[model samples]
Target: MAQAKTTLRTTAAAKAASKAPTNATADKLVGTLRDTMVSLVRRDGPDLSARQLAVFLTCYLQEEGHTVRGLAAELNVSKPAITRALDRLGELDLARRKVDPLDRRSVLVQRTLKGAAYLREIRSIMGETSTVAKKETETRVVRATRRAA
Candidate 1:
């Protein structure tokens, strides 16, 4: 009975693996991210650090009303680290701080036009990179199948 249960579990796992999405999609996403980072550094030349990139993406991707304490907690980092990232972002004109009128002690992280434009450009780069990566992957697969047969 135990042997039968183990066989059944193994078969189920195999079926789940077969039904999983192709690795090509994941590869394309990774390629797109890498290309986007390179483009940001080469073309735009802001040369942001990893933390800065994380903070930037989170702010743009998420809704407004982001606070230092909230961001620090969400990112699992220290408040000073968040503050440093915010400082760098402010210097690059990607983000700014605003005193929350409701809470004088809290500061709000506000988005800038430059930051929005940067995000749009990154989106375009990622789209283009994904398209190219998908085409390459398809071509490679076709060649491999042809050689196999």
Candidate 2:
């Protein structure tokens, strides 16, 4: 009997090792993500999955208006998938869907005040993460210098 072949894939760390200038820098980037996520979860806020967050970010960050079809094409996801994400976002008051005046058949995705506030909060958390990482790196450098003396 012939056995099926299993494909092996290289890990993100392995790929980063080849492209990143330093392991410390790559580690810091990952640490920043972890810390930011932790901060977000600890707050009184909605916890969104990666896909939902991507959809949210795309709507807020991009100035151009979005539609279910447009977002699906832009994010390389299915229209139904985008609709589901939007449903969650609407429940959170982060986004709203509206009937396009020009095209009644299409639904436009709109940004909400709550969504803007959430984005601001995210920015603050990421900034804090960067600051903490910088302080850690500086402390390491100082320790290394002291040990050399």
Candidate 3:
């Protein structure tokens, strides 16, 4: 019962946050996020959970090499959680894990060719979002100007 109440409180907080007014930049960023998500879902690509995508992007974007321990620490998640996400990524052929040559005990997370292509796709989708946001902003400006004239 306590757990259920905590869950309800969390849900209420989320709803309140959504209703909170944000600055134009924050609103625009959220718009971009929404559009990007819609594009990804419309495509036939593998649907990833938020956690999986976070792990994927962190591994790909970071200059430093990634290990299960490193990833967990970087993401503030548990090792098992990282492993689970990696398992899904491996299943999708988007990423792979290899035994580190320097330390056999440690495993390294490496990027796959498919993962690179997927990152490219994400970039393209974000670019499209930027263009759409620009158009929307311009339209708003035009409407405001017409009202003033």
Best by TM-score: 1
Model 1, span 54-142: residue lDDT tens: 99999999986799999999999999999999999999999999999999999899999999988898899888877888888789999
Model 1 segments beyond 4 Å from truth? Answer: 1-16, 19-24
Candidate 3 lDDT, 20-113, residue by residue in tens: 7466678888899889988999999999999999999999998789999999998999999999999999999989999999999999999999
- Candidates 1 and 2, the one with greater lDDT: 2
Rank by TM-score (best first)? 1, 3, 2
What C-alpha lDDT, on a 0 to 100 scale, does residue 67 get in candidate 3?
Answer: 98
Estimate the Cα RMSD of every predicted model relative to the unseen true structure: 3.0, 8.4, 9.9
lDDT of 3 at 98: 99
Pairing residues by index, what is the TM-score of model 1?
0.84
Candidate 3 residue-pair clash tally:
0
Query: Which residue pairs show backbone clashes in model 2?
Result: none
Candidate ordering by lDDT (highest first): 3, 2, 1
Give the lDDT of residue 51 in candidate 1.
98
